[model samples]
Target: MVNPYGPDTRGTFSFGIRLGLLFEVQAACLSAICVVGLLVYLGWTAIRTRRQRGKHALPSHLHVLFVSLLFSDLLHSIGSILNIPWIRDSGVLEGPLCTAQGIFRQMGDTGVALEILAIAVFTWGVIVRGWSSPSLKTTFVIVGLIWIFVILITLVSYGVHKAAGQVYYGNTRYWCWIRSPYSLPDGIALQYGWFWLTAAINLVLYISVAVTLLKSKRRCRNAQMPEGQRSLQKIAFQMTWYPIIYLITITPMSITRLWIFTNPEHPPPFAATALAAVLLTLSGVFNAVLFSITRPTLIPQKGHDHDPTVGGLRSIYTLEFCQRPDEDQRSSKIPPSPETPCHGEGTSKGGGTDETYV
Candidate 1:
């Protein structure tokens, strides 16, 4: 029996279907493992950080970014996991499942964009201020504002299309995503506008982060302490990977989109689409792994020299800074403790001696 919705053997669609299925299966397996690992790592770190909250200064901003990245990657992985079975059976974009898949895909897409933006901002903050980056209040406010803005833009674009009696429906697909073959001017404009907006934002943030890291490294080179050089080097390496991965994942899509726009008569090379999907999928996994490896603090393990005690102490001051004036005053009202000598310091009784402040 002939399959109407199946891949066309004469064209690249057949090859694309095969390739996408292969990649999706591999991605699903890898992503499933990664998701489990991430969840375990996140749980372990959260518990450890919480226990040592008083003794160690936590990198709260970095933690926020880490959480966001994990969440986004998890969502992306979920989308892939769902799509893999569909693709394997050649049932993608069919029935109600297509709409469900589209919703998940959109969710993953938005999550990924927000994750990248959050990481960029977090990295930039670190490069600029190091230990004195913006307070949690400021970071939260900024993230909230960015999310709200993106949501508004998506709604407006969606509404405009629907109002024009251009509500797109598909026989091959169930989701209401912007239909492909965007030959119409309005369709092309919307598609390109989103593409460029995301890419531009990513480029600007990454460039800023790279520049800042470079400048910091140069400054550290002239400093007396060699430890500064090591710290700066680590940061430099981590910051560099982000832009590299971003370009690797997005460049193919950018080129393909441009080519299709310029040469409307020809369809985009199927290889490009396949490459883009694979690279983007891998990017999510890579980001999660890179962060965990680079920032050892994010992964809690025994025998690691990185102390959470100092991080906890730092968190206190940072938290204080983020609180309201009245709350700050209330916190400040706590009396300072008198100096005390340890039990083993002097006395045979093994008791400490307390001395009052002058």
Candidate 2:
């Protein structure tokens, strides 16, 4: 293949650039929606919780999980703001500009993958051990560590490319990224070593979560736990959908990239690249809808919050705390119909939010 900035021998640039730009731009628009929507949601949550003044504290752990995701998604979306007009006019960017774009894109890509894996672990922790929400200090620590890791890994790619003395962030097909990542050491590390490994781990974690849920169900079979208190629907939805959607969206790009590596003699199809570009670019958007917008439906509303012992002692004495949610949910006292528990109820709290989580 000819260098994107070099001679135009392969005739690849003619069709590839325009097609890639078109799809990427569309994906950028969707990415914008994802970022804006998430920010609004986070802001609203913060203000609402503040007004409540500790009366209705939000779940810190869940907040950390989603906020970290938002940060990663924002990075992913930022890379979508390509200099289309500039690119069309100049036909090539300066080396530094190209390098920056490449780095930014990879940060977003790997960041999202890593964040998803984090979420899987979070779900498992809450389910298997009745883990509480993270403290404010812990939240910052986790987020900081994630960013630090991202920065270090991205720098590794940059260092490798610099050492090669080749044009770093050279134009690949239509866009800028680590060129020939499958072949180059730095590129391969970013793509194959980091990104793929995260996705693989996420798969394993989710599968483990599913199996654990089944075993838990068997253990609590005799208990009269409300279905909502079991949080089966919510857990099942995430455990099933999160990994599945991620795999589905990422497969096309993974396949196309690997194919190019294995079979360089034949060029990849334009249609395949277009599909991959759409999926890659809109990943943030899909995640916002799946992980953010639709997630609240699973949380039990304050008024609708079901008391695990609503039916009286007949059910309470026989109910297993193992099958019940957090301790606040197991409390025998009758809470006012409109009053939220001081402690947060987890997914197993009969749709109630974690009360002690505050």
Candidate 3:
């Protein structure tokens, strides 16, 4: 019997069904587990922070942005997890589930790309441009604007298609997304455009930040370099993984999608498609690993305020270099130790600051 959910001839639907059997379902399941693991890690960290409430201050602006990025990744992973249903059915069907999957995928993909770009920009601003960390209020406003844009585009594009009696979130390949005919501009403008743009911007911003940090590191080799300066350099070294992880996760699927767009007649190679799916789905896992690796002190313990340990989430989440508070005016809540004096009140000659707490 012929499958009603797909065309009788060769096309996206047929290939998608074949592809699902070969790979998509397994990748989707693995991705779902990874996303869940990341969520549990973050949740546990938050709980630990809460128990130690006053000891550790609330999360910083940069920390909030990172959480937002993870939230977006969660959305994307949910979308990928939806693939199980389609793969089990062995074909794509036009229905609410399909629409939901498509919506989640678009929103998640767009959200991740935008968030990555925002982080890159913020990091560049703080490190390369020597700008002060933004206020929590400002960070909320920025996040609000990004979500507004994400929701607005999603509504407008999908709504227009619905009104015109068109299938905007229908089968394009192994998933429900922009279908044929309108897939070019609609898909590109709504999602892929942001991905590619963010990738390019990430490359430039990260390269600049890396260069600035390298210069600071070289200067830090001098015996006269402040301990705080050395700390900042070490933190910067760990941060080098940010763009590296992003590029690895985003590039393969991006190329695959672009190829499908350009050469619609010839489907992407089976192995290539499978690889892209696996890599793309593993984004959350990669990010979670990076988070743990870079933010060693995500859940700081009490009494460690004076710990000589430098770098990690202390820089990403708590450091505030902008105000450069007067030494006398600094809060006495967290006393400074000779080994790890609160850098909140001073700046190094190389323009780095210890600002390790609001």
Clashing pairs in 1: 55-309, 56-308, 56-309, 56-310, 56-311, 56-312, 57-310, 57-311, 57-312, 58-311
- How many clashes in each structure? 10, 10, 0
lDDT of 2 by residue, 1-358 (tens): 4453441213334555665666677787777777677767667755655564455444455456666776676666666566364336434444666667677778877777777777667665655455543445676687778778888888865787589865567566556677653245655566555667767877787777677555645655564565544443343445457777778777888888778667766768868876886887777777777755334432436874333322211121111224334435556453322212122223243433323221
Best by lDDT: 3
Query: Who is ahead in TM-score, 2 or 3?
Result: 3
Which pairs in model 2 have colliding backbones? 229-348, 229-350, 343-355, 343-356, 344-354, 344-355, 344-356, 345-353, 345-354, 345-355
> Against the true structure, whose TM-score is highest?
3
Candidate order by decreasing TM-score: 3, 2, 1
Model 1: per-residue Cα lDDT over 98-140, one tens digit each: 4344444445556556656666655555543344544556666
Q: What's each prediction's TM-score? A: 0.67, 0.74, 0.79
lDDT of 2 at 328: 50
Q: Candidate 3 lDDT (Cα, whole model)?
A: 0.66
Each candidate: what lDDT? 0.49, 0.59, 0.66
